[model samples]
Target: MGRKLALLIATYAYEDEGLRQLTAPGHDAVALAEVLRDPDIAGFEVTILVNEPLHRVGAVLGEFFHDCRHDDLTLLYFTGHGLKDDEGRLHLATADTRRTNLAFTSLSAEQIDRAMSGCMSRQQVLILDCCYSGAFPAGWLAKGDADVHTLERFQGRGRTVLTASDATQYSFEGDHVSGSAARSVFTRHLVHGLREGTADLDDDGNITLDELYVYVHDKVVDEMPQQRPKRQDNVEGRIVIARNVNWAPPVHLGEEPTARASAPEQMPLLQVTPLSVPTPVPLVAGRMRWVFRTGGCVRSVPAVVDGVVYVGSDDGALYAIDATTGEERWRRMLNAEGVVRSTPIVNGAVVFTTADRSLYAVDARTGALRWERLLGSQTTLTVGIVGSLVYVGASNGVYAYNAEDGQERWRNVGQGMTSYQWMVLTERLVIVGNTGSHVYGLPQADSGKTWATRIPHRSVSGPSALSDDMSLLYVGNSRGELRCVGTSDGERLGEHGVTGKAIYSAPTYVSGSTESPGTIYVGNDDGHLYALEDFSYERKWRFVTGAPVRTSPAVDDATVYFGSDDGIVYGVDVTTGLERWRFSSGGPVRSSPTVMHGLVYVGSDDKGLYALQATY
Candidate 1:
């Protein structure tokens, strides 16, 4: 049997003073429209209401109530301004709404409840994205001691209600590019979680309503400690709103044949056998460890190989440290004034590129400079080692140098304005993006560029993983937009904008299956660390800090680590998005964190390098 579903999206941008003046027209309405059209929920029949004429909320509600009755599953969504009257009744404001005649222009909770009273199906879901919606109130429960006595008569019903904030709280407004103003804090996380598929923690094809609620509840509280989302649920039975409908049922045929009716005969006595005892196996614990730190700010990532840790710092030096101890073995100073923002790439006995604008190859064991070359005047460099060749990006172009001699092999300069921060090398081609909003695919064998395609926006950070199949290239932009561009011709596959202030950090990929897919972690200027799944682009979880997060995230196993501008380093649960622990620092952290052995290495603007014991 086919399932029936109804979705209603309503937004009130007209009532918001800031929203009314924004140049971006239909931003909130368009966001809701996009969700409605998402392929994941194609089975749903969606109805949208936005800034309707005043004195017409009743007519709109009447139309929705009538349509919802025919659906086997119903979902009603609202996004707008809500308030409470002197009587404590919750009311949704309309476009031409006035405080004096709110009853005529706005719809109250009581009116909605009465309208939905006649719904036939047991499954009904209501999502209220408005201020003071928590005050809408559920059915009255007996007070105090009387509640215990009345519990026996209660029967579970399939009804769930989720509101944006508590009765006394107010919603916040972010930038217009973010899509909405006066949006409920809880709603932001809820929509993000749903879109990103973070609620599917087990990697199940279906996402349950309970999972969605739990993720949103925790993230909202973490981001806004004062405002709490209210949830009321009596729906115990799981309903499949959508699924892979193409599945075929197994076929079988049965006939009413003669029954064999003869076994009232003999019963055998029970026998007991003595069981042999099994030997217990002893468990062994792992013991090897390593630690390394740069004397100044260790703003660069560390590369571990051959029992040594290699890292760079703002002190303009690269250090090789013992893999098992926190002691440094040797240090080589690079002749540069700028900090090292690139990780050291190791090939054989040579360690390379520990400075921002120069490429240096040093002996892996002795820390002696083998060869040094100035790559460019301004380069957002990150090193990629492919076989014996090394790939690097600069403001001018992408360069390939022989790792054996530090000699230039070939350079691909698409344009003078292209500022490439990162590049990934494939067997046949090299993929890189620049601040000019262009991504180029260059052939490794030829000096000329293979293809160049413009990205949706300017990319300021490094490019993340290129799909194993080399089908898509994922990159994050300064505006918090994450996009997957085709590796073939740079055609846009899909894009999802992060719902934070701004994204200054690069994205990291988790290694896993496509179904249980890897995660993309990035920090935002809004002081939050977000984990988004790669397959569905659904948000897994988020951790909030007191300030912006300008550092990239580091992931090892099931834990995620990142530093924030609030001068704190956090370890979070990868699946549940819960904070396991946090370590305080002296100043703002702009450097990306590196996790190796059992320690987390990071640097702060306070001129100190920190090492914290990794606690699972």
Candidate 2:
């Protein structure tokens, strides 16, 4: 029933020569204050102190906690340099703090503990984003279990504490270069979750303290593997921290929004349109809807279902983002050993492969892991899901698992597969491209019964698409040979040669309805996207790009969209192969485009997931 209060302290301009000047504390404080003070969000009465002297900070810190009542919710956040004294006691450095005389010049953990102990608030939360901030409770009591004893330091009945790192680690500063905005890696995610409402893990319009800690913890570790954020809780009940501004009422895909929902932005962004290429009707790229930033490069192809877009990143986590706002909903850590380069497949569950040579199945709604299976060391390709079965190709062989339980159905060994082999799933067969200029079609009923077809070229590096009748399969090899093989048998029907050095982009086949001849769209390492006639393998037109077009093109009614290694996503006319519009990202884009509704979604190596919409 009482008001919410917050005291945010940041000290970066240290006077002592031994103390290192930090660039993120001031920026972190300002961002946190804005989110906490917003009436629609946290609605906290905030008192922020930036670069204050030790004496002034101590006085304000004491008075801030002293004014709280038993029913009030009090939050204390500090971002600065946390130092240790000769006795291994923790001290918070301030603007005028000296390293030589820490006991008198800096604020000690004991002093803050004393002020917190005297405060009447039972709902108290302490967040420390600093080097060695985890030593606060241990340094104060020097007693029992670290977590339990830390909770006892504060005299309040229910209190929670979150630190940027454990006692032995240092908090990291991120993107603090000459021209970029300075930000602490830990606090940056904190503000992002609160402001974007991503910390609302349940999507119930409320963000709790525990949810905030978990969101920040995963994001921090993904960016800085050396730093592990810590959280110790002794709260009796959930403490609601903020209201989710981005929360939208649950509306299933294809269903109209309820009266409570206002517009497209208030609804979950879900893709209903299928992805095709080289259709009769062409579409053009309009304006950029939004771009979502992650901690690392985003090379994983995104899967859109309902209103959430699921994608993996080099940051070692799978993120589910809202399609409309480009704000994250939830992120789950898959593996620490390797980055996620495989595109995610979302069925009833989400399936993806990490660089660690493992396949993971997680719940679609909450991102909770359902099951995981270890594969061959080279198993890192995107998985294919058909019905209740999931298929993948590894260096050793092809493997199949039950999509629901992750149970191994079969493994056909001795066939050589590569990381780039794009497994093409059909009604009766799982067609896979290999590294040795060979393609295999393993029968769905029996993976052991496989048919191999040899291409008179180098390795097959991309995916294969079926003809409109599903009787012919077309695959491209590293030697720039487009080979068409009969689906029933592995006999090569025909081949078309190109001038490109290689072709890593998967070929997409569009039927063009019953009126037009089928067209095939593919990209080449020679920096061009080619549109070819399906049966005759005749080149209709070729569109040139600045760099290699490594991404497969996604086609809708009027346009074919794809990304180039030059860091640009281009929309081209499907019929003429003429350029329509282009959007540039910060880094190279290897992720394929996904088109649905009136929007196009793709990822870039620049750590961005972009959503571009067509102007009506």
Q: What is the TM-score of each candidate against the true structure?
A: 0.52, 0.53
Residue 70's lDDT within candidate 1 is: 44
lDDT, candidate 2, 223-293, per-residue tens: 88877887777778899888788777898999997666532222221222211111111122235789898
Please name the candidate that would achieve the greatest lDDT relative to the true structure: 2
Off by over 4 Å in 2: 1-286, 416-420, 513-515
Report clash pairs, candidate 2.
269-307, 276-555, 281-557, 281-558, 282-558, 283-558, 283-559
Positional deviation of residue 74's Cα in model 1 after best superposition, in angstroms = 46
Model 1 spans > 4 angstroms off = 1-295, 336-338, 354-356, 414-416, 468-470
The lDDT per prediction is 0.61, 0.76
Best by TM-score: 2
Among all windows of 10 consecutive residues in model 1, the one with the lowest summed lDDT is: 277-286
